[model samples]
Target: MYFCLFPTWHSKVFRNDVIFIYDKYFFNLWFDLYLKYFFLTSELIILISSLWV
Candidate 1:
């Protein structure tokens, strides 16, 4: 389900740009997702640790 959203999202972003630049930016979306997930997970871990303490 998550993967499906990515293609559509990238296509939308690509619509406004040239092919080469658009492909690069579209690929960066995955990196963005990784950073977002990493940040959220780290925050969750910190919150849980504080509660435990």
Candidate 2:
């Protein structure tokens, strides 16, 4: 999902910034959480749509 990926890309682009460096671990953790959430949501949607049909 664009929402999930955008923040990671933004953080990578700003990696040299002082604030970004300080929160690098947080970003990594967030990125993982977003990826998991995205996949889970997508799968749930598919499951629900299949059941609907």
Candidate 3:
């Protein structure tokens, strides 16, 4: 899902010259959100497995 979204996101960033000014900031924000979502999902899975066990 991330891989699929990345191409379009990357293209949008590259296509808009003005956004290039804040590209690093935007990329960092995107990465942080992704990581948060990934970790939350992982923790939920672990918790569920523990409950099952």
Candidate 4:
């Protein structure tokens, strides 16, 4: 499972508390980037389609 991999993935192993903190921060940053990229692409698609029509 994805949860099981975290402990061994790092060069220096960390405690679960540390791993959990890392997971939370990584997820939040990735989620924010994904949302911004999704919105920008969607708007561009709409703009292009309208201009083409």
For candidate 4, list the clashing residue pairs, or say none. none
Model 4 TM-score on a 0 to 1 scale: 0.70
lDDT score, candidate 1: 0.71
Q: Rate residue 38 of model 2 by lDDT.
A: 100
Give candidate 1's TM-score: 0.56
How accurate locally, in lDDT, is each candidate? 0.71, 0.72, 0.71, 0.70
TM-score of 3: 0.62
Estimate candidate 1's RMSD in Å: 5.6
lDDT of 4 by residue, 1-53 (tens): 65434433542455477766777676667678889999999999999999999
What does candidate 3's lDDT look like per residue over 5-46, in tens digits?
Answer: 453465465787665545656667778899999999999999
lDDT digits (tens) for residues 1-53 of candidate 2: 65344545655666667656546666678878889999999999999999999
Superposition TM-score, candidate 2 onto the true structure: 0.58
Against the true structure, what is every candidate's RMSD? 5.6, 5.3, 4.4, 5.7
In model 1, pairs of residues that clash are: none
Q: What is the lDDT of residue 47 in candidate 2?
A: 100
Best by lDDT: 2
Ordered by lDDT, highest first, the candidates read: 2, 3, 1, 4
Q: Ten-residue segment with the worst summed lDDT in candidate 4?
A: 3-12
TM-score of each: 0.56, 0.58, 0.62, 0.70
